[model samples]
Target: MSETIPAGKGISAAQSKIENRLIETVVESFNKTEDPRLKVLMQSLTRHLHNFLREVRLTEDEWRTAIDFLTTAGHITDGKRQEFVLLSDVLGLSMQTIAMNNQAYKGATEATVFGPFFLENAPEIAIGGDIAGGAAGQPCWVEGTVTDSSASPVPGARIEVWEADEEGFYDVQYGDGRIAGRAHLFADENGKYAFWGLTPTPYPIPDDGPVGQLLESVGRSPVRASHLHFMVSADGLRSLVTHIFVAGDPQIEIGDSVFGVKDSLIKSFETQPAGTPTPDGRDLDGKAWARTRFDIVLAPALT
Candidate 1:
C-alpha cells in the first residue's frame, strides 16, 4: 500500500461521493431525449443546477427541505392557479428574468410581469371607454398610445388589460361576481388607446405556501404597488407585457413584494371634469376618477 497520498487526491473519496448526481441523471435523460430544444433546456438546466449545488455546498437536509417545499407548492397549484409562479413573482425572479430577455427592446416600452391573472377572453371595448364597470376604489381613467421603435403608431394593436377591484381583488378572487372592467381593445388607425379603469392598489401576494413562509422569514410584506397590467401586441410587432403605475401611489417608487415596479412605467393621471360619456354610453364622472394617458412602443418581431 502506498503510504504517501497523491497531492490532488486528498479528498478523492469525498469528491467522488459529492459529485453531482442530478447532472448525471440529466445527462442520461438527455441521451434519451430527441427534441433539440428540450435537449438544450435539459442540458442548461443540468449545468446550472449542478453549479448551484456545488457553489452552495448544499446539504442533504437543505435539499430535502427544498424538495418538500416544491412538493407543497405543487400540491397547492391548480388548473387556474400556479403557486410556483406566485413564488417566482414574490421572489422577483419572474420580473428579473423578463427584464433580461427583453433587453433587446431599447427605447421601446419597458416590460413588466404578465402576473398570474391574465384572461384570453376579455370583452372587447372601444377607446376612451370605462373598463371599471362601476367597481369602487379611486375612480381612474387610463389612456395611452401604442407605437413602434421609430415612434410610428402601431395601428390596430391589441391591448389586453386587467386589474383588481376597489377591494384589491380580481375577478378570480371574488369567485362569485361578474368579470367586469376586464377587456381587450384595439388601437385605432393612429395607434392611440385609452380607457377608464380604477387605479391599481397595492395588493398582497397570496400567502399560503412555502414561498410565503420564506417571505415571512425575511420580514418582508407581500404588497405589490398600484398598477394596471397590459399585454400589447400588434401586427408585425413584438408582444409586450407591461403595466402603468398610479402616479400618486406611494408604492410605485418603493420596494414591491415582487419587484415589478419600473420608473419608465409611471404616468400621471390627469384629472378631468365630470360627465364624459364613454363610447358605450357610460358616463365617466371625471371628478370621481383619476385619469392617465400612457404610450407603449413595441419592437418588430423577429421572424
Candidate 2:
C-alpha cells in the first residue's frame, strides 16, 4: 500500500470498511432529527462531504486551515460587512441559490444575488427625490415603473436601491456613521418612480479578509462589475432583487466576480454633456450627468 490512497482505485469491502462505517455512523446519528427535510439535508451533507474528503485525500492540515478560514469569516461579519456572503459570492454559490429560488415567470425582471451591503430601515424618499443623499459621483436620473406580470401597474410598490460611490465604497464602509447612496421609496398611483443616484462604477469587493486570501490563492480577481442594485416588492407579487449593469462596461465581458450579471439586465446609460437640462430641472452647476430608465415587471407570488 502506498502512503497516500491511490486516486480512484476501487476500495474493497475490507479496505473501505472502516471509512464507510464511519460515514454510516455519522449519517445514522442524524436519524433522530425531528424535521424530515433537515434529516435528509444532514445525511446528504455527510455523504457528500465524506466523499469529497476521500476523493481529494484531504490532509489534517488542510482541514484545520479550512476551519480557521471559516472562523475568520465569522469574526469579520457584522452590521456592515459579511465575509460569508463574500465567500459564497466568490464560490458561485450565491448566484446558484438565487437562480433556484427566483425562477422565470412571465416578464418578471431577472433576479440576482443580494450583495452584502443591504440594510433594513432605510430612510424613505418621495417620487423624484434624491436617493443619493450626497454620495460622491456623477449625478444620474433613474426612472422606472413597476408592473405586474399581467401588465397592470402595481401602485405603491416599494423599491430599495443601494450602490457604491465613485470611490468604490459604500456608506457603511465609513466609521463616521454616514448614510448615502441608498434609499427606499414607493411607486406612485401610476406605478411610476424616479430618483437621483450616483452613476454606478466598477469596484473591488472588500479584499482585506479571509475571502480575499482565498481568492488570491486561486488567482481570481475580486472586482465586481459596475452596476446599481435594486430590490422591488409589492403586495401579492414576488419580490425581485436585481441590478442594472451599464451596457458598455468592459468588466461584463471579462466577468462579474459574483456571477450576477445578465444580458437582460444590461441597459444603456445615456450620457449628457455639461449644461444638459436635468429631468426635474435640478441644477448640476455645469457638471455632466447621466440617465437611465428601468421598467420593472414582477412575477406573481406562490400562494
Candidate 3:
C-alpha cells in the first residue's frame, strides 16, 4: 500500500500563513486590554478556539450554524428562561465548573449547580409556615439546622428554599404570573428551621427552546431527579448552594440531566399517615405528608 498522507499536508504555504496570522492577530488585539485578567482570558480563549477549529477542520457552514444557534439561544432567553444556562447544564460544563470551584471541605456540605430556576429575593416566610403558596402537591415538612464545620449551631442563618410542585412545574412555569413552592426564612435562635413544601418529584428541563432541540439531536433526555433546592448562609461562613435529593428517586441512579446530584445529598422522605402531628404541631388532619431532615454544614469564610 502507498504511504498515507498526513491531514492538511496539501495546504499551500500562503494558506498556512493566513491561518497563523489570523490567530496571532486575534490574540494581539487583546494586548491593550486594561485588565490583566481580561487580557489573559481573551488571549487564551482565542488560542484555544483557533486550535479547536483547526483540530476539527470546521466547515464554514458548521461555523455559520453555530453562530445561528447561539443567536437563537440568546433571543429565547428572558427573565424567567435561561437557554444559555440550559445549554451549559446539558453540556456538563456547569457541573465541571462547580466541582473545580468547590473542592471538598471537611464536614461542609457539597455544593451543586445553582440551577437556572433560582429567584433572588424570594418571598420570606416564617418558620413552620408553608411555602407551597397554594401549589398542588403532596405536603412535605422540611426541617434542618445550620451548623459550622465543627457542628456547632449557627443561629440567625438565612435559608432560601425552592422546588417544583409534584406535577414537575415551578411557579415560573405558570403563565398567569404566580409564585409557588419557594420561600426564604431565617433560622431560629437555636439554628433550626422548619417549613412545609411539596414532595420533590422528577421533572424535565424546559424543552421547547434551542437547548431542548440540542438535547433531542444528541439523544439525551432532559429529566432531572427529584430534589429540593437550598441556599444557606450565615455571617463568617461560606454560603452553600445544594440540594437534598429524594432517596430512591428512579432518576437518582440515572445521571441527573444537569449533573447536580451527589450521593451525600440524598435523603429519605419519610411518609407519614394522615393525622400525624408535624414537628411544629400542625395537624395534617388525616392527609398523608412527607418529612425530611437536612442539616447544613458551612465552612468558615476567608478573611
Winning candidate number (TM-score)? 2
Against the unseen true structure, what C-alpha lDDT does each candidate score? 0.76, 0.91, 0.88
lDDT of 3 by residue, 202-268 (tens): 9999999888888899988899999999999998998888999999999988779999999999999
TM-score for all models, in order of appearance: 0.85, 0.96, 0.93
What lDDT does candidate 3 reach at residue 117?
88
Which whole-number lDDT from 0 to 100 does residue 157 have in model 3? Answer: 98
Where model 1 places Cα greater than 4 Å from the true spot, the runs are 1-13, 16-29, 104-106, 271-287
**Which candidate do you rate higher for lDDT, 1 or 2?**
2
lDDT of 1 at 164: 87
Better of 1 and 2 by TM-score: 2
User: Which residue pairs come into collision in candidate 2?
Assistant: none
TM-score of 1: 0.85
RMSD of 3: 4.2
